[model samples]
Each structure stands twice: as C-alpha cells, then as structure tokens.
Target: MTLEFDLFWSFRSPYSYLATPRLAALQEEYDVKINVRPVYPIAVRIKGFFKQVNPLWPPYLLKDTVRIAEMEGLPYAWPSPDPIVMDIKSGEVPEEQPYISRLTRLGVAAAEKGKGMPFLYEVSRIIFGGVKGWNEGTHLQEAAARAGLDLAELDALIEKDPDHYEKTIAENEAAQKAGGHWGVPLMVFEGEPFFGQDRISHLIWRMEQKGLKKRS
Candidate 1:
C-alpha cells in the first residue's frame, strides 16, 4: 500500500528550497506520494508579517539558511528579484506583486498535472541556486522541461483560467492553516501537521510506525 502526504510549500522560502531534495529522495526510496500544495509566503498572506516579527529574525534566517545549505551541500543563494516584492528594511509589501502571483499560479498548475514536486524543485533551485534573472527568458522554460513539464503549456492553462488557479492556491492556504500551521515546508500526514524542514525525520519516523515500506 502507498502512503501519501501533503507538502505545503512556498517559492520564497529558503527552507522550502532546502527541503525539496530530501522530499524528492523520500518519494524515490519509499512507496509514498507527496501532494504539493503551493501557497503564498507569510509576507504576502499576512499583511505586515515581517514588520511585526523580531528585527533579529531576518539576519538570523540568512545566517541559518547559508549554514544549512553548506551542511546539506546544496547550491544556495538569496533569490534575485525576490518572489515577493517587499522592502527588507521597512517590511513594506507592495500591493501590486508581479512575481509571486504568477509563480504560485504556475505551481498550482503543476500540481494539477501531478508534476508539482519536480517542477518546484527544479524552479526553486534556479531561483535560489544563484541564477541571475531567474525569471527571464528560457530559465523557467528549461526548468519546466527538466521537471517533465512544458512551460508554455502551463502558461497557457493559467492564461485560460487564472481565477481557478488562484482559487486553488487560496484553498491550499486555508488547508494549511486548518492543518495547524502557517509555515512552509510543512508536511501533513494523516491530518497531522509537521512544520519545518527539520521535522522531516520525525515525519519519516511516524511513517515507519505506520509501516511505510521501501519501494521494491
């Protein structure tokens, strides 16, 4: 029998980027299915989220993500033209966000096609793995291809029915909250929410308890 879980993720999250490879590995090594649920980052979901948080959080996050990447041996860098357009110093997010909306919509589209995890892993790596102008030209196109998807097709699907994609993302966000957390890289199994990249091992332990089997 195959076990399945929902992966609540975000493009703007460095931890989500870090978590992708391991999540991919889990599916490769075990008979488990991961349903990718893409949601807008907290900065977008909760207005003034950054402004209300501790001032020390951002720098610590940067230091931690860098160290984590080095420890994991995954290529890492802060995204250029960040998915969410916000002033880092003031924590002011613009109402007109050009990047995150499109990216989240595309992620929903990928999920619909059952290729969400691969698409996100490939695309996030491009954005967070030091690619300059990651959104320009063939960058996304090539990434989609690597994930066994056609970027143009995804774009056309979104173009044809953008509201549906947005609604799907909204539902994902609501489900994430209903599952008990608002953070990215959350894995929900059997209605239990495991929040954080560090909690993956615990998730697997629980899976093992439930008789998770290796792929033969």
Candidate 2:
C-alpha cells in the first residue's frame, strides 16, 4: 500500500524551493505519493499581510533562508522578478500581478498532467537557484523540458481558461488554511498538518508509524 499526502507549496517561498529536492527524493525512495498543491504567496493571498507583519520578520527571513541554504548545501538566491510584485518599502502588493498568477496557473496545469513535483523542482531551481532573468527568454521552457513537460502546452491550457486555474489555486489556499497553516512547504498526511521545510523528517516519522514501506 502507498501512503499519500498533500504538499502545499508556493513559488515565491524560499522554504518551498529549499524543500523541493528532498521532497522529490522522498517520492523516489518511498512508496508514497505527494499531491503538489501550489498556492499564491501570502503577499497575494492576504492583502497587506506583509504590512501587518513585524518589521523584524523580513530581515530575519532573509538571514534565515541564506543560512538554511548553506546548512543544506543548496545554492540559493532570491528570484529576479519576484513572483509576487510588491513595494517592499511600503509593503504594498500591486493589483496587476504579472508573475505569480501565471506561475501558479502553470503549476496547476502541471499538477493536472501528473508532473507537478518534478515541475516544481525544476522550475523553482531557475527562480531561486541564483539564475538571473529567470523569467526571460527560454528559461521557463527549458525548466519545463527538464521536468519532462512542455511549457507551451501548459501555457496553452492556461490561456484557454485562466479562471479555471486561478480557481484551483484559490482552492489550494483555502485547503492550506484548513490544513492548519498558511505557510508553504507544508505536508499534510491523514489530516495531520506539518508546516515548514524542517518538518519533513517529522512527516516521515508519522509515515513510518503508519507502516510506510519502500517501493518494490
């Protein structure tokens, strides 16, 4: 028998990017299925979320992400055109978001194609792995290819009915909240929510308790 879990993730989240390689490894090594559920970053999900946060949070987050990347020996850099476009000075998110909406839609399309995890791992590397101009030229197309997907096809699906993809992301956000956390890189197994990239080992412990087996 295979255990299944939901992975609530976001393109703009450093933690989500950090979690990808390990998550992909887990899927390959264990008899488990991870349902990749991509959601918009909190900057877009909750208006003024950044503004309401303590001033210390952003700096601490930056410091922490860099250290975490070093600790894990993973290359790390913030996205070039941040998936969420916001005025960091004012903590104001723009109404016309040109990046996150498209990325989230593509993620949903990939999930529909049963390649969500690979897509997430490949695409996020471009965005967060020190690549400059990640949104330009064929960066995304190449990433999709690396994941064994077609970016053009995924884009066409979103172009056909963008609202559908948006709706799917909305549902993912609501589900994440219902799962007990609004953070990305969240893993929920049998209704137990484990938030943050650091919680992965704990998630596996729970899986072991549930008789998780290796793939034959």
Candidate 3:
C-alpha cells in the first residue's frame, strides 16, 4: 500500500520550517509521497491571530523550537525581521496580510506545475532557515532557481492564472473539510489529520500499524 499524506504548510511559521527536514526524510525512509500544500499562515488567514497570541507563546515557541532544531542537528535561526503581519505605523495591531496571500498564490502556482514541494522547501529555507532578508530580489531569485523553477515563468503564471491559484486554495479548503485543523507541516493519513513536526514520528508509527508496504 502507498503511504501518502497531504502536508499543509505556511511559510511564515517557524514550526513549518522546522517541520520540513523531518517530513522530507519520512518520504524517503518510508517511501511515501508527501503532497506539499502551501497555505497562508495563521497571521494571514486569521485577522488577529498574531496579536492574539499570548506574549509568552512567541518566546516559548522560539526557544523550544531552537532546542528541537539542535536535537535534530539542522541549521536553525530566528529570522531577524520575523515573519509576522506588521502595522509599521501607529504600532497598533491590524491586518496587513497581503504578503502571505502572494506567497500562497505563488505556492499554488508552483504546485500546479508539479514543482510545489521543491519550491516550498527552497523558499522556506530562505524565509526560516536563517537566510537574512529573504524578501530581497537576489535571495528570492536564488531560491526559485534552486527549486528548479524559473522566476519569470512563475511570476507570469501567477499574474495571468487566477483560475489555477484559486483551484489550489480551494483544494486546501477541501482538505480542511476532510478534518485537517491546523497549518502546514500537517499530514493526514487514512482520513486522520496529524498536525505539527512532532507528529511525524507518530504518523510513521501509525503507518506501520496500517502495514505500510515498502516500495517494490
């Protein structure tokens, strides 16, 4: 039997970034295919999600995630500028979520061309894997190239392909309807949704229980 699952991911979430290496390895070790589904992070999807986060939550997650990264021996760093919805002026919390919308659209566009997973991994590395100022042109272009994608082509596709982008978003929503309750780095196995990087091992264990057949 093929052990496959959909991985819903957010570029802005550190957890999502932290989740990739393990998720990728699972695909290799278990010979399963992980469908990389990119979605806007909570900050973009929910208007006040960032502002509503408990003050302690950010620092705690940051520290804990770093420890986890250390344990995994993967390169990790907290992006200096941070990937959050910002209200630069007034210092008041408000929705400035267009950034993630663009990212989600791009993600969907790449996925449409069967390049979604690779594109996301490269992009996430720049965004969360400690590359400074990922928004700059050079970094973005390099990430695109590394993923075997043409920057110009992806841009054009996103600009002229509303139907494709909308279809990707619709698919994500449909997956949620089937019971995925959280952001990217989530995998659904046998209709059961598993969220977070910590759950990957558990997912593998479950797949074993279900008699995941090794590739022939």
TM-scores across all candidates? 0.98, 0.98, 0.86
Q: What clash pairs does model 3 have?
A: 8-184, 9-184
- Model 3 vs truth, CA RMSD: 2.6
Candidate 2, residues 32-133, lDDT tens digits: the string is: 999999998888888999889999888999999999999989989988978888898889998998888889899999999999999999999999999999
> lDDT for each of the candidates?
0.94, 0.93, 0.74
Ranking by TM-score: 1, 2, 3
Clashing pairs in 2: none
All candidates in order of lDDT, best leading: 1, 2, 3
Tens digit per residue, CA lDDT, model 3, 1-216: 676777788777778888887776666667677777777666656665655667787779879989988887767887745566576333234555455667777888777777777787788788777777777758878888888888778878888976778677777866855765866567788789888888988888898888876665
Cα error, residue 97 of model 3, in Å, equals 3.4
**Model 2 scores what on Cα lDDT?**
0.93
Which 10-residue window in model 3 sums to the lowest lDDT? 88-97
